[model samples]
Target: MGRTGGKGLSLARRLYTSRILGLVLGLLCVSVAMYPLDPPAWVWAVMLFNGLVWPHLAYQWARRAKVPYHAEHRNLLIDAFLGGFWVAAMHFNPLPSATTISMMAMNNVAIGGARFLLAGAAAQLLGVGVGLVVFAPALVPMTTPAQLYACLPLLMLYPLALGWICFRQAYTLGLHKRELLALSRTDSLTGLLNHGAWKDQLEVEFERCKRQQTGAAIALIDIDHFKAINDTYGHVAGDIVLRQLSKMLKQNLRMADVAGRYGGDEFCVILPDLPLFNAVQAMEALRERFSFLVYEQNPALKVSLSIGLAALDPAQGDATRWLDDADQALYEAKAGGRNRVICCSDDKPRREVFDSV
Candidate 1:
């Protein structure tokens, strides 16, 4: 019931505005046909209630029900029944009767597709039966000019309104799908690409550099003693430190550079179309800039980065190997000291370590 209600409640709400428009237009169409036949005072009163009051009442009924979706379905069948009843009461006038039945069918199909259409048809048949018992079966074959004009507003306008509603729903669902996809790829804390998304882009960068025989580089950055920061300061303070690093990455990196939170206490960057020398310089500048950031919460709280860089190696077959190379350089940076940039080169046997004083 809970699951059913979750789906059903929205159905009722979505239908509410459509119901108001459809029923009001249908009333105008049905009323014209019934006018010629001279319905009794009670019939006229019933028509008014169905046209004006029933839409609101049906909405409330479905909305308040435990299984709102089921309640709304019931409300739609009732709508079909009323449409049939009106057709019979009007002596089955051609234009108005067809308009009323088609409008109801359109509404039913939009709600539940073919199955609901069949169910609505059955309800309409039952309504016709009851209406026949009350008013006696009679056929009015010809449609007057006035009746045709009355039905025109319903025939033309209601479909446009319903179509627009469906369009709006489709557009909104598409927007939500795009947003969800972005959230899935992003790290919630750092707002950088998540581990998986970053790796995927690394693969693309590796292929691009290898195929073109162009130089690029990948960097692994570790927040020095990050766990100690959480242990010394609160986790909240540790989180702020992490966010600070991400902000600096965005500010320092070029648009072509891809950055991501590789894992706990570690970030990664891919510098496309950049030589090994320039990549090292960029990492060094970033390292220096980050070392100076001061937190307002803890003015004395200071932090630094350990960076390891690996240039694109055509000899390296896969992205993981490239990542592993950077990881090894990062290990060396941490081993050397807490605040410096270390460049790992495929061309050289000895790695270059830049220790900032």
Candidate 2:
């Protein structure tokens, strides 16, 4: 598969420091075991280069690769191979050998989970086989005092570095998830909660009213003659009008009010812990202020709103019935006149009109 942008590069950068630290420390662990063996001049030189120089070369290799993520994985396998080679070079001294291989296992699991761990193990075995051929492999079960102390830095500090890296990765993922959730709930056009989110809030409000015996109101608003506006003055102009209404809703409503785009040219608001008469006054004020907003696209292009309101009735069964009442009142308002607020009632007329001045 083709590598996506920067994924491999990011992995390489994250591992670079840990790689340098581990290799240098591993050199110490291996050197103590190799000392008694009286290894030749070339073997000591190779050890120094592998410990002090190889990390920089590996970083450059990954950075320059066309697919940095894939390149980094190859680098990890190479490290595993070298780790096993050193264990054999040390003649498999018990403490140093276990320490070296276990650290390599931790890194493989941290980078790519179990699958990569197994792959690293295979690479290590191959390295051990090559070492046996090249160096006449021998096993030394005892760990002297010097070898034990040399292994301590790699054993103690490498895991701490690896652990910190893992924690940072998890934290970054958490932040991305939160951003995605916000985008999912919000309407792109008006920057308000979308229809479904608002409706969810409505259901919560409904249950609250029923449980606490508190008052709340629902308002369903429609832009009057919206299609005519779009036809006469382009969809862009119509969109400007919609945005203007949404801006007014956000600015005028109280913090407790839940407003959302009910879907194209229509909007909804839930006023919690508010009385019926107050909600009507609030809607009327909004209608009047919105009527006076002059559009920059066409100064002559005037806009108006028709809103329908329904207050909480303890007798109401669910959120749907409450919304239906407001929808019916909105229909009544449009039938009565273009610009007005209609309040749904249980009385004889079943609708009360509040005309715009």
Candidate 3:
């Protein structure tokens, strides 16, 4: 409710500013039209109140209302009615009358589209009828050169201001849309790509590798004995370990590498243009680095990684088959003892053991 109120207040303030600009210029146009006839003192008083004072009054009315949106909308209708009254009061002087009506119509359309435009038009017609009853029913068809020049400022400047406001709104909405899309694709915990988003990228990488006939490798990394870590040191420490690994992946991989949290204590990486041997060496170095990390919660705690690597095979039918190969290699790594890298080739799986210092 507070947020809604703030939005309403903001809208009311914008409407207030727009009214000030429109009415100030409008007053000049109307004053020029009525000068030759020497209208009554009351007519001048009304014009002064509408041009100089009404914008502030309308703003206060909307700001104080229980629902400012509805109040501001009602204020717009009043603006339309006043515009009609002025047109009739000017005795339908061609330049001022058309300018007044067209500006009100533009305001109505901008605020509430076609429906409000029609509603405002009806209100203006009613004001014209009231004017005919109160003042003389007359229309002056000719517009003097002075009147044409008087209408110029509102005609040129008001539309420009309105267009700028609309463009700003469009640009803001586009930024919000892009932010939402990025959030949707990112993992909440790791700030990396989520599982589904990573799979989508995997398919794209697979297609690229097949088309270009380039060497690329994918690795599935699992934290050995992660469930035991969570059980021994609590989930918070386990979360710390996961975050540290994600940080390492971000720091070690190239900009082109696609890394993601593949559920539980497992992560996935797609290394473009890298051979199986180099990919294994990279994973082994990452594993050794992660093992040396010291946690604040547990000084003696130790962790190790089991990594499975697979190079893109020309004989592979689809991305799913390629993923299955990586998964098979991961199973072999787990089976061949927990802290090692296993590479799956077209013929057989090979294990690489390294010092666990």
Candidate 4:
């Protein structure tokens, strides 16, 4: 799997493991508590120790790891382990007092807090349901109706705490995803769309133009004598030249224009709702501006670009054809002598060319 896919899978595995662990701990706690001092105290103590320490170990590992942390899983696992340990600790005491029951109720409080804080409404309901399942043996069989009535406050408390906790966790996760996506799609050096992101945007724009019957123009641009500049001034100067040219292109284009570095010394622009003639004119102006711009310590140095322009055809409905046409035009511009804009129509074959290879 790719890095992103692996990261996503790891996140899912952690969440699934946490949930299963919670279910197991809940079952273990309730089953152990049901015995009512039938077993040795050391057995219960051992169980408690394992329950508490194991989840803490996992939680700490997740916190330290480079992988993205899912707060819901962390909180749930911690609460589940703690709740199990609390019940086991009570089992070790063998005291059938109100204090024992209160301690069990407090276990529910901790579970509720983790659930509500990290998982929201669904977690609140889940905490209440699971708590009821764990504590049912003690609460449901009470001889007095008043004793059952007194449990209401704790019951309501679980859901409310769970809801609050989960809501905050959800918001934080959302913000993190948004920031990660932006960074992934952006070019770190040029502050433009990266090649992958630019391709995605182009496909979407192509579909939109096809559906809306809107004209779209694409220009393939290359910096003239880029290697000579790099060889003469050093890589740092080359990078500065690229950055300045990117800035100039961005500033010169319309607000709706989308530009990206296709590869080293090559750039592409997607102009939506633009005609072929206007795109040619725009490329001409850009070439003129670039020719006049001075490079560092090279006063006599002249810079020029060769541009190929292609306009989308609604009848054809093929984005690839537009790019192919632009590529042919770019070849023609280079052949006819560098530093000029060439359209697809300008590269048509002569009458006698049909006989030649």
- Top of the candidates by lDDT: 1
lDDT of 3: 0.87
TM-score between candidate 4 and the true structure? 0.58
Write candidate 2's Cα lDDT for 101-169 as tens digits.
999999999999999999999999988887888798688889999999999999999998889888888
Report lDDT (CA) for all predictions.
Answer: 0.91, 0.89, 0.87, 0.60
Task: Give one digit per residue, the lDDT tens place, for model 4 in 206-234.
Answer: 89988897878888888878899888877
Which pairs clash (backbone N, Cα, C closer than 3 Å) in model 4?
A: 116-162, 116-163, 116-165, 116-166, 117-165, 117-166, 118-165, 118-166, 119-166, 120-166
Q: Write the residue-wise lDDT of candidate 1 on 1-357 in tens digits.
A: 323355588778788998899989988998888888888899989999999999999988887787888899999999999888888888889899999999999999998999999999999999999999999789999999999999999999999989988998889989999999899999999999999999999999999889999999999999998999999998999999999999999998999999999999999999999999999999999998888999999888889999999998888989899999999999999998769889888798689989997
- Using lDDT as the yardstick, the better of models 2 and 3 is 2
User: In model 4, what lDDT does residue 188 have?
Assistant: 73
> For model 2, where is the 10-residue window of minimal lDDT?
1-10
Which predicted model would earn the best TM-score? Answer: 1
RMSD of 4: 10.7
Name the candidate, 1 or 3, with the larger lDDT value.
Answer: 1
TM-score of each: 0.91, 0.90, 0.89, 0.58
The full ranking of all candidates by TM-score, starting with the best, is 1, 2, 3, 4
Q: What is the lDDT of residue 144 in candidate 4?
A: 35
Kindly report which residue pairs in candidate 2 clash with one another: 8-69
RMSD of 3: 2.8
